[model samples]
Target: MNNGYFGFCGTPTRANSQNLAEKLSCLHLDAFARKRAEKFGLDIVTTSWEDNARSKNSCWGPCITDMSLGVKEDKPHPRDFLMSMIRKPNYRDETCDTPIEKFCVTVGNEKKNSSLKRITLKEFLQDIALYTDNNVKPMWRDRDSQIVTSVQA
Candidate 1:
């Protein structure tokens, strides 16, 4: 999943600033990640955002929703394998802050017997590659697209 920037800076005029919102509205990192996941034959299950501080029960920042691989039937209990991605931005005003991109995989119920690991997007994809017997390399492109590199494992 991808996350949207709060806003943009360095605009010369009001008109430019207004246009920035429109141009950037569709440019989200989660969307790109979703595309990469789909390219690898993973099925998306759901997309939702996390609540911010102002919202009720707002502990986590805004984040994209959960996705599933649809491989539950192979398991005895029919538990769905799920994944979630979060793109965290680093605000310039926040000293020493760095951007964070993380992906988490869950094999069973989130509340029980689930193997959840939060790792870098690259590491997560590498794990996916190992799991699926496919060598996966995700390349960043402009907001419009992504380049996926895959080799049979």
Candidate 2:
């Protein structure tokens, strides 16, 4: 399954870019993505990034490695990541956003079974928890708590 990065909606200035990174970091994206995938009954086969060679190189050691799957420190470029997913035949675009809002999209066959609904951050996290309880091993208890706390704050 492919996952899009956050904060890819517009041309960001330097300050805006930093703000985006901070937001992404606070979101704990890797954990959130894993939970979302599980909620949709999808197993993560692998993860990848789409970026120019320079960006890829810079991200390689810390960001794109297998071990970095849920690492909080690995901030990814959302626009590049989302564009990469858009190119894939298996993914379907489910949501759109303007420069001021964040973007959301769906991957895999999940779209075939359900209508595309707007996914809120809270709902996404709840879905993740549901998926963890029903389909997979119970591993996200702490992560869910963290997400809830983060969201509340």
Candidate 3:
């Protein structure tokens, strides 16, 4: 998600729905998140970063049509399985940013059976960027981003 500011924050979790939505919305506004979301079958278009005040100017693109995994029969990835299953499947539109004071109270209520946890959009995008740039290998293993932590002695 990057948020165009902080570096890697962390993966999304189930607790921070509003923050996650904000991050997603910000990322959607950028070129990088749009490209990655399309490739991964994520439903990014429905989200609106702006609340009612800015809804008229918000952008709406194609909705995510494919939520299936890359593997045949939509097999779940190892990491995906380890994360929250019920909450993991849930996704938020980036454009849904209504201030609590002005908007309805029930808008961002927490869910009981979500499969994924809420993570900062920056972390989410970082994860996707890492995979896209390095063929899914962690940054530590990437030739360009790898750091020399070992001592010769």
Candidate 4:
């Protein structure tokens, strides 16, 4: 949680009677964390992932979505098997101004890439300002100011 700057950062899903980490983030946690970060003179990001998962009590979104290869299902595209099963997220709000703290992408396929597919992924990242003005800003830039530090490994 931003190196102790945050206290109760969590993911989209809450546990069904689970540990503190599984507990959904609430006002108490946020206020405490905010106060602590401020007391430390830190401007760290402190937000939890919204519960975009469709099921109310599922342990994992994928388990609820239950996407499968569907080997026997008549599929139009190779990716369609994975895509058609999961519920797409609707941010509840219509605007695109939500600030992104981090971006993580995990792909199961490790085989050769198609030129068309590769270009699409490249375009997607570029559209999100992931390159950060050609490296002017590093990722997860969640600070009030930028301080370039030199560390010896």
Candidate 5:
């Protein structure tokens, strides 16, 4: 196809993925996907971990590439987004920020025969969250845990 790069999401969980093991996994897998895509003429874009605060160049590389490759006019460029960021104060999330509205969410799993369900975000949270004194909190969070990365061909 075009002279573009291939991408893979959900690594580091984006480390622009979530941790060290994930970051490395993303980098290596990005390399592998790139190679595979070359054979079929495809370009995939993924957010990867950079040395600077694990961010710095995260979007810069992909943004430039996207613009150069003729992204749709409706999509905002990174530079335009930055300009909007400076003037973005009116938007608000009533569900998460104010709790005034309960947004509907789709919940499901990858298991076969499992049916998806649409429920209020608050209701979904009640299943996985703990409530005390009217305050809602998550059941648990990752805390400096180590993870292993491996690949097989």
Candidate 6:
């Protein structure tokens, strides 16, 4: 799993570049999948972004280590911290801004799964997202919450 910064889509600024940035910013995950999709010339099926409100140094650090690590000086792996934050979105679900806390991953037997773990705020940031029906893929399956698809016009 990958982690970093995140945000929600606003409105399109330019034609595609600005619009793409807004859509990308709205996702609860980093630009990993988006970047990968662009790299492989694959059609974008999801709108995700990097959660920048969490940490600067590393997402999996000071917070977890602060409690779990015996030594106060030892640093934890940044990836671990990033994973934690990427699991949850930092927003309310009452309005268009629904919180996204799960990530999309390929599981064995051709299954996709999203894992929810505990992460420290000092370790990871969160992505703010706007509500939309543009999502056609399931964020995670065989999990607790039922995944829904929403598209944006």
- Top-lDDT candidate index: 1
Q: Write the per-residue lDDT of candidate 6 for residues 1-153, one digit (tens) a residue.
A: 134323333443455343333344343254564454435443233322233233543444332211111112223322211111122121210112223344242223322364444442212222111112243443333332322322221
Candidate 6: RMSD to truth: 19.1
lDDT of 2 by residue, 1-153 (tens): 233543245566785566443454444345654465446543233333322222322544332222112323444533312111111111221222232113233423354475555653434444554423356433423333322010010
Please give, for residues 46-65, the per-residue lDDT of candidate 1 as tens digits. Answer: 23232222244443445422
What total of clashing residue pairs does each candidate reach? 3, 0, 28, 0, 11, 29
Give all candidates' CA lDDT scores: 0.35, 0.34, 0.32, 0.31, 0.34, 0.30
List TM-score per model, in order.
Answer: 0.20, 0.23, 0.19, 0.20, 0.23, 0.13
Off by over 4 Å in 1: 1-117, 126-128, 139-153
- Clash-forming residue pairs, model 1: 1-30, 2-29, 2-30
Error (Å) of candidate 4 at residue 4 is 7.3
- Shift of residue 115 alpha carbon in model 3, Å: 20
- The parts of candidate 6 lying over 4 Å away from their true place are 1-29, 46-153
Question: For candidate 6, what is the TM-score?
Answer: 0.13
lDDT winner between candidates 5 and 6: 5
Error of 1 at 94 (Å): 25
Per-residue alpha-carbon lDDT of candidate 5 for residues 68-116, written as tens digits (9 for 90 to 100): 1121223333311110011101111011122312455666653457788
- Model 3 off-target regions past 4 Å? 1-21, 47-153
Instruction: Output the TM-score of candidate 2.
Output: 0.23
Which segments of candidate 2 are over 4 A away from where they belong? Answer: 1-59, 65-101, 106-114, 129-153
Assess candidate 1 and give its lDDT. 0.35
